[model samples]
Target: MKKIVFLFAFGLAALFAQAQSPAKIGFADVEYIFSQMPEAKQIETELQTLQTQLKKQYDGKVAEFQKKLQEYQAYGNTVPDAVRQNTERELQQLQQNIQKLEQDSQENLQRKQVQLMEPVYTKVGKAIEEVAKANAFTMILTNQVSGLDVVLYADDQSDISDLVLKKMGITPQAATTNPPKK
Candidate 1:
């Protein structure tokens, strides 16, 4: 009975010790880190170029649509029934094509954004992991820059965002080092 009691007390003491140790928690602003990265600028330029091309395509289609519409209106009354019907169908098809292009362009832009950012995200993720491990942080939460409410409040000392930027070889901006006020 004494031996069992001793084992129970030993276990309780161990539990108490473990419970007393505070977890090292830190926060990183991934968005800030990503913004400071050169890859982000490249991605933005590429996306802009793609957006410009898509816009040009959209503008051309609208011009074509407008031209057809004007032509139909100009000679619509003089044209035969069959020609009028065909022109109307063509105009309808062109409208559908324009709408389809708008949708496709939006989707394409989103896909391109994700594709371009995938590598950046991976690189940042690796840097965050390294920083957390090196700093002895048990858990790192996303800073308030993210729309998530995971972290309600965090001390300035607990912010490792600058460390993460340094890990990625980017100099963090001075403003970013300072945590925002509540």
Candidate 2:
């Protein structure tokens, strides 16, 4: 058991070392771009409204299902077997319908996300390329799950997020242009 544990630990260490030992490496987080972009809040609001609309449109079926389920539960001990079976069947069908609606909503959300954010994402890609070229970066990466990226204490002045955002033609929130009303 000790040998097996030692071997496992050694293997994991070797794998981690290999992963960390890139010859030329850089790091940037796309999350930062999205969070900082002025367009992101507008897109998020649109996404929320779309979800709300879908829920409203499909609410009747959901409400009916809930009502039937309540009735079935209330009469569970008193109802005839055939009535119980029929209610169960209807409940199953309602669940399947709910599943289909959920799937459709998810697909629509994905499609809308692509449509709405592709342009912004494209700009971010271009900006990253510009940063890499300007800074002579060989490989830019990211470890931006929540906190600061692992960079062995590089200079904060060396961080190029501001430069990348500038290159993308994105103005600061204070300088953002207002959209014209229809």
Candidate 3:
């Protein structure tokens, strides 16, 4: 009985000691980091250029196919039956080619988005580490989205997002979120 009581008392003391220790917490929203970077604008421009290129490719092919169809239709019944059938088959093949082009372009666009963002995310991670160390943070977290459970409320003052972005030489276009004032 004495041993059990002593153990309970010791556990209580340990808990008290832990509660007194410094637990410096910090948080940064990485979405803001990406938005604030100067290179972010450059990336957006590049994405637009890619879209224009894909559009040009698709439109050019479609226009060429339409022109050929018009030429075939103008000849009407004067064209030999076999030759007309062959042209129709070629037109079907052209449609298939367009479908393949669209599918390939979509996949390539996704690939480009990943390629461009991966390095930016890496740089942001390193900047986050540097900011945490410099600020003597015990633990730094990203707005804490835990497996389908998001932390909806965070104190804005606790948000170190701007600091981290600045450290990375980024200028955030938007403001950081602050907890609702009670």
The better candidate by TM-score, 2 or 3, is 3
Candidate 2, residue 162: Cα displacement in angstroms equals 0.1
Spell out the clash pairs found in candidate 2: 26-141
Best by TM-score: 1
- TM-score of each candidate? 0.86, 0.63, 0.73
Q: What's the TM for model 1? A: 0.86
Task: Give lDDT: candidate 2, residue 135.
Answer: 80
Give the poorly placed runs of model 2, Cα more than 4 Å off. Answer: 1-26, 57-59, 71-85, 143-152, 172-182
Instruction: Give candidate 2's whole-model lDDT.
Output: 0.75
lDDT score of residue 171 within candidate 3: 62
| Residue pair clashes in candidate 1 | none
C-alpha lDDT score of every prediction, in listed order: 0.88, 0.75, 0.80
Which candidate number maximizes lDDT?
1
lDDT of 1 by residue, 79-177 (tens): 899999999999999999999999999999999999999989899999999999998999998866446555667888887888988888888765633
- Candidates sorted on TM-score, descending: 1, 3, 2
- How does model 2 score by TM-score? 0.63
- Candidate with more favorable, higher TM-score: 1 or 2: 1
Off by over 4 Å in 3: 1-26, 133-149, 171-182
lDDT, residue 82, model 2: 93
